[model samples]
Target chain A: MNQFIQELTKGLWKELPPFRLLLGLCPVLAVTKSASNGIGMGMAVLFVLTLSNMLISLVRNIIPSKVRIACFITISATLVVAVELLMQAYAYPLYLQLGIFVPLIVVNCIILGRAEAFAAKNPVHLAIADGLGMGLGFTMSLTFLGSIREILGAGTWFGYPVMWDGFQPFTIMVEAPGAFLCLGLTLAAMNYGTRRQLMKRNREGSEASASPCGGCRACSIGKSQD
Target chain B: MSVFEVFISAIFVNNIVLAQNLGNCPYLGCSKEKGVALGMGTSVIFVTVMATLCTWLVQKYILIPTGLEYLQTLVFILIIASLVQFVEMFLKKAIPPLYASLGIFLPLITTNCCVLGVTLLVQREQYDLMDALIYAFATGAGFLLALLLMAGVRERLETCRVPKAMAGTPIALIMAGIMSLSFMAFKGMV
Candidate 1:
């Protein structure tokens, strides 16, 4: 239980997918024109990520090391297809809004990255926790970014007008460039916060500050190779 | 649309990276060094065009005929994965020097949403074979163009003083945002 909570909370803030780990960025930049769209995309990803992680963890021992990646891709692709059908039937409008990004979720690095790094080694319950945590983190980040863009870009949040009548929307906030700029600035702010925290910890002469990459299993794997 | 117009629109008006927002992983990951960026761009061009051609045929002959259109995502991804593997093996044996330069990036291409995105886009737009091929090529070229420009800027960024918090990916992303804004100017050209 303790381990599960640890795994769960880590994804929430310590190893947040888009903002911190920087995985699965394509959809992050593309589908975030409004807060609702962000929630929609987040829900789809949450479904796939949680289920795929559970499935992969259950079969970890059966999968050959050499063929694991192909297996992972196949599993996620199937889930994404299920998501497409479900969205088409129930959420047709959002299906159209998200468009190619729905299918593109199959290639999202966060899903694949977690499958390879966390699920393949952990038990099913822990894997579920990790997936749930990561999925929620991803959804929160997307919604936050989307809300900022939508409120500023369209003078609305979740499609409701929030700004004064004469407020001029920064139309660029909803465009491709604004997505990049907003995300860039958000990441920088996060970094600033982390830096200040580290400095405060050091001034107290506490135990050495944890490495930013300490919680990032993916980067650790890459570093081990080098 | 005319072939010329499709080609121009793909490269400028609807650039795969700048306009469509696909393949950003490679756009940011590989653009730090000019040489790596060039290699990655070339390999993307080679794989995207080939994958488009093969997937187009598969969609026409197999998926459409069998009424398995619902399986489009699964089948396209499988085909692309296998296609990239074959291309990597063929390049390694037939063209050693080219393989040496592009070797590392080939496997990464399997997961690149750009290749799959282009194949799906052409089908969505109902482009004929010739138009599909040209569009795929032009899209790849646009990606290359964006990456090269970004690489040049990053190389220069190395010497400048950057804030501690915005030193690496943050600053690079802001730069990409600015570049994307400039690319928006081309919207009127086509």
Candidate 2:
């Protein structure tokens, strides 16, 4: 239970796909102009990631080492096709809006990265948890970033008008340029926050020690290791 | 669309990397150095042309005839992955210098969405084999053009004193965004 929680929550912040680890960046910048589209893409990814992870984990032992990557891609591609068919059938408009990205999900490095990095080595349960966690993390980031872009660009939150009548929307936010700038700025802010937290922790630890314990090389090396 | 228009449009207006948001992973990762960027770009051009041509033939003859269009994703991706592998080995055997330059980026191209995207687009747009091949070549050339431009910018960016947080992917993406905005001007310039 505890390990499962660890596997899940790790993806939420510590290993957030887009912002932290910089995985699956295409959809992050391309399809995230609107919150609805972001959420929709996220859901599609969530479905694919969870199932692929589970299936890959189950067959990890039998797969040949040389051909495993190809095998993993084949599995995910099949699932992506299924997702594409389902979306086309039920959510025709959204599916059309998504365009080639639906098929492109088969090549999303995040999914393949997880299958190789986590699922292949772990038990099925942990792999599924990791998948759910990473998927949720990716989806949450997409939705949040999308909402911000949507609100600022279109003056709407999930297509509802949120700004004052006279307020001018930052039209760039909803375009390709806006997606890049927003993600860049957001990543910078997160990095700054993490650095500040790490610095605070170091300072607190240093304050508790009165004696000078390290010289130039050792102190620099210690911080570098941290 | 005429072949000339397709070539020009893909090169400038519908750039796979800058506009379509395809091949971004390798676009960002391999655009650091000019030589590497060129090598990656050339390999992409080769793979794009070959993959689209092969997939088009497969879709038209095998999948469509057999009523297996639903398996396009699985089939195309498998074909692409293997195509990349075959290209890698053939390149290594035939051109050692080129192989050395491409190095790891060769394998990375296997997962590049631009190649698959072009192949799928060829099918979706219903381009005949010759047109599909030309379109793929155009898209590949467009990718090369964007990558070279980006590599030049990044090379220049390295000298400037950037902020701690925005030094890497953040700034590269912003630069690409500006480039994308600029590329919009070339739209409909047949």
Candidate 3:
């Protein structure tokens, strides 16, 4: 239970997909224009990630190492297609909004990265925990970013008017350029905060502040504690 | 639109990176150095054209005829994956210099959304063989242009001391935001 909890929490902050590892930026940037869209896309990713991770973990031993990448891509792509069909049938509005990005989820480096790195090595149950953690982390971040952009850029929150009419929205916040700027600022702030925490911990006899790693080294991901 | 207009529009007005957000991974990943950026750009162009052409043919003949348009995503990704692999091998054997320069980026192209995005867009827009070819070139060219610009800025940034808080991806992204804003000027040119 403790190990499962650890696997689940690791991807939340220690290895947040976009702000931390910087994988899967295309879908993050493209579909995160509104909170609803972000949630919709996030759920889609969660479905695909958790399922693919579980499936890959189950068959990890069977897949030949030589063609594992090809195998991973195929499995994920098929899952994405199924997700797309389900979305189209059930949630047509979101299905329309997401469009190509839904299909493009197959290529999201986060899924394949985990498949190769974590799932292929771990047992199925642990892989499920990791998948949920990463997927939910991705969801939270995307929704947060999307809501910020939507509120500032469109003067609304999830389509409801949040600001007074006199408030002139920074329309650029919703555009392509805005996506980059918003994400950049968030990353910078996160890195700065983590560095301060690291410094304080070092002062408290942690003695691990000799080198300030960006927390991006894949080998050391989810190692939040010394 | 004329081919020239299409080319210009693709390059500036509807940029693959900024406007369409098609290829942010490699745009940021490969933009650290100008030379590598160019190499990746050329490889993307080659693969985009090749992938677009092959997928376009398949969509028209195989998927559309059989009423399997829903399988476009699955099939296009497979085509793109194999296409990138084949192109990588071909470049390695035939054009070693280019291959050496490309390095890991060549294989990375397999999952690049831009390659698949181009094929999907071409199919969506229903471009003919010739127009699709031009579009493949234009989309790749546009991506290259954005990448080059970003690389030039990043190179200059390395010389100057950046603020501690905004170094790396943050500053790169802010720079991209400014560039995207500038590209917005070309909005109505087409």
Candidate 4:
């Protein structure tokens, strides 16, 4: 249970897919024109990631090591097709909105990375937890970035107008260039926050233990002590 | 659209990397060095055109006739994966220097969305065989153009002072954004 929670929470912030791990960037940049679009893409990814992780974990023992990647791609590709069909049936509009990205999910790297790194080695339950965590983390990041772009770019939040009538929308915010700029600034801000927190931790650790490592999180030396 | 128009629009207006946002992993990953970018771009051109042709034939003969169109995602990806492996082996045996230049990047193309994306796009657009090939070649060239431009810029960026936090991917993304903005100038040209 403890390990499951650790796996789950790590994806939320510590290893958030787009911001931290920097995986699956194509969807992150392309589909984030609006908050709803982001959530939609995220949900599709969540569905594929969770089920693929579970299936891969269940069959981990049977798959040959040399052929594991091909196996993983096959599994995820099947799931992506299912996702495409399901979306077409229930959410036809969003299915069209997402377009080719739905199929492109098979190559998202986050799904393949998790399958190779976690699901292949871990048990089913833990793999499920990791997938759920990473999926939710990816969803949260996409929604957050999407909301920022939508609000600034179109003066709306999730299809509803939020800004005053006088507001002049920065149309570029929801365009191709805006996606890159917004993500770049967001990553920088996150890094700055992390650096500040690490510095504070280092100061406290120095006063308490006179440690030689200075409690820097970037290195593994201080991690074991913590 | 005319084949000539398709070629022009693909290379400029709807560039795979800057405009369409496909194959970003390699666009960023391989663009740090000019030579690697050149190698990656060339390999992508070769693989994408071949993959598109294969997928198009399979779609026309196999999936559509068998009514297994819903399985398009699964089948196309499998074909791409196997095709990439075959290409790698063929290159290693027939053209050692070309294989050496491509190196590991050849295998990585199996997963690059641009190849698959182009294949799927041509199908979605319902292009005939001739148009499909031209479109694929043009999209690949667009991707190559974007990658080379980015590599040139990033090479210069290496000598510049960047803040610690935004030193790597963040700054690279910003540069890409600027390049993308410039590419937008070609929007009306098509």
Candidate 5:
């Protein structure tokens, strides 16, 4: 039980997909023009991830090592197709808004990375947990981006107006430029937080040590190894 | 309608990179180095042209004729993945040096949204085979051009002493914004 919690928690912050690792940004920037689009894309990804992970986990040991990547792609692609068909049938409007991204989900490094790293080695239940955790992390990032861009770019959230008419919406926020701005600022904020934490740790360490001179010895050893 | 318009629009007015915003994975990831960027650009041109032709046929004959158009995405992706594999293998045997430079990029192109996006747009626009091929090659060339320019700027950005917050991807994003705005100048060409 503890192990499952550890696996799930890692994806939320320690190994967040877009912000931290920067594995998948194509869809992150393209479809996040609105909050609804972001949530819709997130759900599609979640469904694909969970289904693909479970299947791959169930058949992990039987697959030969040489053809593992091919097998995984086929399985994942099949699930993506299934999801695409379901979306087309039930939610045509959202499906059309998503456009090519639904199919592009097959190439998303997040799903493929999770499959190669976790599902191919672990059991089905754990794979499901990993998928849910990672998918939610990705979804949360998209939703956050969507909210910011929608509020700033269109003066709306989920297609409803928020800002008064007098306020000028930054048109660039609705275009490709806005995508970059949102992504860059969000990543910089995260990096700044990490750097502050590192500084705090360094300060605490220095207070405990009698001399800062001795720390250079360890630093030099580490540098030499590099 | 004219070939010139197809070429011009694909290159500037409706650039795959700056306007449509496809092929961004390589645009941002591989644009740091000029030589590698050129190689990736050439590979995109090659694969995109071939894949567009192949997809045009499948869409016309197989998907539309038989009412399997809904399977377009799945079938198109499969065909593209296999075609990329075949091309990589053939090139490895035929031209070893060219293959080595472009081999790593071949696999990446299989999943590039620009390649698939062009193919789908060709179908969506109902272009003939010749036009599709031309548009695909032109768009790929545009992607290459954008990457090379970005590579040149990024090399120079290394020395510019940007800012604490907007150093890496942030600065790149801002640069992309500027590029998009510049490209907007050519919008009326269509």
Candidate 6:
């Protein structure tokens, strides 16, 4: 149980696919012109990831090593197809909006990366949790990016108007250039926060050591405690 | 559109790399050296042409006829993955120098969106066989052009003192944004 929580939580932040790990940016940038588009793409990825992870985890032991990658690709591709069909049937608008990105999701490194790295070695239940948690994390991150871009670029969220009258939106923010700007700024923000935490930890460690009677004495004490 | 027009338009008007913004992972990640970029471009051109032809055949003969368009994505990916493998082996056997140049990137081609994007775009536009082939080749040329230009710029960027915050991918991304903006000038050409 604890292990499941740990695996799932890691992908949300510590090993996030886009923001942290920077695994899959092609789709992240391409389909995030609108908030609804982001949500639509994210949900599709979540479904594909969770199912692929579970199935890959279950069959990890049975699959031969030489053929594992091909197997994983096949499984992931199958799930992507299933999701693509379901979306086309039920959400034709989003299906059209997402366009080729839906099919391209099959090649997304995050899903394949998770399957090969974590899911293949873990139990089915743990894989399931990790998949869902990571998927939701990816979805939320994209949706947040989309909301910012959509509202600023078009003065709207999704397709509806959100800004006050007389506001002139930045056209580039909603286009291909806008995608780069949003993603770059978001990455910088994440990097800045991470750097701050690292600096803070170092400061606290140094302060703790310096406050002691002696450096050697403190080091010895810490070692003994450990 | 005529075959020449399709070819010309793909190469300039609707370039996969510049206009469509597909396969950006390699564009940003690998476009540091001109030699590498050229090698990567050659590989992309080869794989994209083959993948498009393969998908075109599959779509025309199998998926559309069988009413299995939903499986198009799955089938395309499988074909691409295998085709990449075959190309890798063929390169190693026939041209070791080219193989060395394209070494690791050949495998990465599977995930490079430009290959898949070309396949998808060809299908979406419903191009005839000649049109599909021309578009695929021209799109590959466009991608190569963008990558080479990006690499040339990056080679010089290494010496210039960029802002500390925007030193790496951030600055590269900003440059890409500018490039994308410039590419917008060619939008009405079609």
Top-lDDT candidate index: 1
Better model by TM-score: candidate 5 vs candidate 6: 6
Which CAPRI level is candidate 5?
acceptable
The TM-score obtained for chain B by all candidates, in the order given, is 0.99, 0.95, 0.96, 0.98, 0.98, 0.95
Name the better of 1 and 2 by DockQ: 1
Instruction: Report the number of backbone clashes for model 4.
Output: 0
Weakest ten-residue segment in model 4 chain B by summed lDDT: B163-172
Which TM-score does chain B of candidate 4 obtain?
A: 0.98
Question: With candidate 2 superimposed using the best TM-score fit, by how many Å does residue B124's alpha carbon deviate from the native?
Answer: 1.5
Task: Using DockQ, give the best candidate's number.
Answer: 1
State the TM-score for model 6.
Answer: 0.91
All candidates' lDDT scores?
Answer: 0.90, 0.85, 0.86, 0.88, 0.81, 0.82
lDDT by residue (A1-226, candidate 6, tens digit) is 8987887787777766676666677778888999999999999999999999999999999999887878998999899888877987899999998888998888887888788778899889999999998898899888998999999999998789989999999998988888877887776566555555556766777543323121112112111110
lDDT (tens digit, per residue) of candidate 6 on B1-190? 8787888789878878666668877787778889888988988899999999999999999898899887787788889989999988998999999788887788888877789889988998989988898899999999999999889988999999974445566667777887878888887877
* TM, chain A, every candidate: 0.92, 0.90, 0.92, 0.90, 0.88, 0.88
Query: A22-100 in candidate 1: lDDT tens per residue?
Result: 8888999999999999999999999999999999999999999998888999999999999999999999999999999
TM-score of each: 0.96, 0.93, 0.95, 0.95, 0.91, 0.91
Model 1 misplaced regions, further than 4 Å: A207-226
What is the Å distance of residue B42 in model 1 from its true position? 0.5
Could you tell me the lDDT of residue B78 within candidate 4? Answer: 95
* Candidate achieving higher DockQ, 2 or 3: 3
User: Residue-wise lDDT of candidate 1 within B119-173, one digit each (tens)?
Assistant: 9998999999999999999999999999999999999999999887887788888
Worst 10 residues of 3 chain A by lDDT: A217-226
Please give the ranking of all candidate structures by TM-score, highest first, separated by commas: 1, 3, 4, 2, 6, 5
User: Per-residue error at B159 for model 1, in Å?
Assistant: 0.5
> Which model, 3 or 6, shows the larger DockQ?
3
Pairwise lDDT winner, candidates 1 and 5:
1
lDDT comparing candidate 4 with the true structure: 0.88
Q: List DockQ for all candidates.
A: 0.57, 0.46, 0.55, 0.46, 0.34, 0.33
